[model samples]
Target chain A: MLNYFLFLVISFVMFAIGAYGLLSKRNMIRMLLSAEVMFNSALLTLLVLAATADPIRGGVVALIAIGVSATEIGVMISVGILFFKVRGEIDVYKLSKSREQKSRRLKT
Target chain B: MIDIIVFAILGTLAIAFSLLVVEHRSLVYGAISLGFLGIVNAALFALIGFTFIALFHLAVYVGAGVVFILFSVTMFREIPTVEIRVKRIALVIVTLIAISLAAIFWPYSNISVVAQSISYRELSKVFTEDYWFPFLVTTIALVTTLIEGITLARREAR
Candidate 1:
């Protein structure tokens, strides 16, 4: 019980930190990484629960989740590559504001 | 007992490396650390005996995904660009506080901890046997994602 509780606490703390990283990081790669952090933390939570369960299914589900996430990571990495190809930098601030300015100007 | 110790150590390593991935300036190092983190997670899945998921996790993540990240990171080689970095001190402090608060509250609210329920067997069976529609959907999703991945990578080759 104590171990399980500790797992949850750690996982949630990781998730929150990841969330902040995702939200606040100006670099696109960092944002992608923050998302990964949030994901692994959740995966840990699932495994802990599965471990404690009467009939353990946690590992199986986690496996599938990891597969899906890996695919997502592939996409994110590609997106980063393409962005770097065009922009020369992976800063979200420069990317978003430039796009936003274009749209705002076009609208006006 | 063995599982608990392994989980604790692996979990700590995972958390620390993930933080490094988030903080590392070089995209190459971030991607490399991310791959290691993914590998650790896949191992954790294996220890728990989900062979199918672990295999795919290794195949798709550590195999193809990491390669792709490294490929993209290398594209920066020809471009003389200094990476635009993250520098939000206030955001970091706020995030630290939020994480601390969440860590305090999360353990108490977990359903399994509250119910002392061991539903792992049930969920596994439910996933494999009678309730398999979701798995089928996941299969289709994986196929489509693969197709999309290939398409996304293919530049107009004349």
Candidate 2:
């Protein structure tokens, strides 16, 4: 009985905000948080899409997605820690610039 | 009628909290907002009859994910200073793309609005019998990731 369009709109708006944060935020942890939001948006859409046919299936799938996302957070947090240990900073801009320089050096 | 009302309120709150998650200056504040968003989404799941998913979402996402994020935020306590970047064009482009995708998908939403009743037993049977391979793979993957994370973090400790 819920309006599926309404739910989709909410998910899409959340996704846009997350994408904006991912792009604009320089902090690595915040970027990860934004990524979580984007992941939630995808899960929301999937759940809503499957709600009408077989919610149990959606539930199982959502469970899998949730587990995968948790693993993702764990691995990424470890990487963030490693990055901070090596660089003493967690700014995405600086990290990306360094990566670009590394790539250019390899090409040379 | 009640379902629609509940869904509306939950969806609105989820969206609002998600915005706060993205826009908050403090990392802890953003993580808390993200937790709230997860809670609202779990409620939204329940409202639509996915009770088991809602419960698991609440337990895994709101319970574990938020705590993990908070722990990560605390590990690097140095607050990042705001850097002004000329990213207005990027924002506009992302917004336009999202809006177009929404418009294109709107018609399909109306077609599948009906909620069919399904039980947890049915889901488990199907998951174990048909998609058991994926389920087993996920378990293995999770365990491996945990081991890798522990190893990675411990190396820093040493």
Candidate 3:
């Protein structure tokens, strides 16, 4: 019981850290890294719960989730590369600011 | 007893590296930290007696995913440090969410923590027999992503 609680706490902390990063970070790559952290936390939680209930099913789901997450990271990094190539900057704030300015100019 | 001690050490390292991944100023260092976190996570899975999942995670996440991020990070010679505009707000939101989650999950704290040793044969049987459809979908997604990645690489080469 104590061990499970400790693992849950760790998973919770990781999830919080990931959330903070996702919310506060502006760099696209950093944001993706943060998202990865969150994904990992969720996976850990799933495995912990599954261990108590059904290990086989948990392992299978985790395997598929890992595969899906790998694909997600690959696609996201590719998009990040393309974004950098086009704008030469990967800052989310700057991207949004540029879009706002464009809209304002169009309104004029 | 030994497993708990090992898990505690790995969990602490996982949290520390995860923080580094988020807070590191240099994108390359941040990516490296993410890789380390992945390694710690794989170790945690292994500690739980899921060796196959541990190896798969190490291979896919640490090997391929982190490498891809590192490769992309190298392309940017000068990455400006991202300024945090709403640290207090973000902190408040995260705390609220964490508290709510804890409350929801408090009932399950009494569950036993037994390390179940799962073999590859049983895992494959369950994967193929029960969850084959999801597996098929995942395979399709993987193939599509591979094709898309190849196209993107070729375009960049041109």
Q: Score the docking of each candidate (DockQ).
A: 0.38, 0.63, 0.66
Shift of residue A86 alpha carbon in model 1, Å: 3.9
Question: What DockQ results for candidate 1?
Answer: 0.38
| TM-score of every candidate's chain A | 0.86, 0.87, 0.90
Quote the true-contact fraction of every model.
0.31, 0.65, 0.67
The parts of candidate 1 lying over 4 Å away from their true place are A54-60, B1-8, B43-56, B77-125, B128-131, B156-158
Error of 1 at B106 (Å): 6.2
Off by over 4 Å in 2: A101-108, B83-86, B109-116
Using TM-score as the measure, which candidate wins? 3
Give per-residue lDDT, candidate 2, residue B23.
81
Using all chains and alpha carbons, the TM-scores for the candidates as numbered come to 0.72, 0.91, 0.93
lDDT (10s digit) by residue, model 1, range A3-108: 4566676676677767767766776766787887788778766876666663245545665676577668766776776676676677777888899999999999
Alpha-carbon lDDT, every model: 0.67, 0.82, 0.87
Candidate 1 lDDT: 0.67
Docking class of 3: medium
Candidate 2 TM-score, C-alpha based: 0.91
Order candidates by DockQ, high to low: 3, 2, 1
| Candidate 2 structure quality by residue, lDDT tens digits, B43-149 | 87776667788888889888987888787788786766575484696599669968997988877766636655677688889889877887898888889888987
Query: Across residues B1-158, which tens digit of lDDT does each residue of candidate 3 receive?
Result: 67768887998999999999999888899999999999999888777677888899999888998988898788886677657779899999999988888888888777757777887798899999999999999899989988988877777522
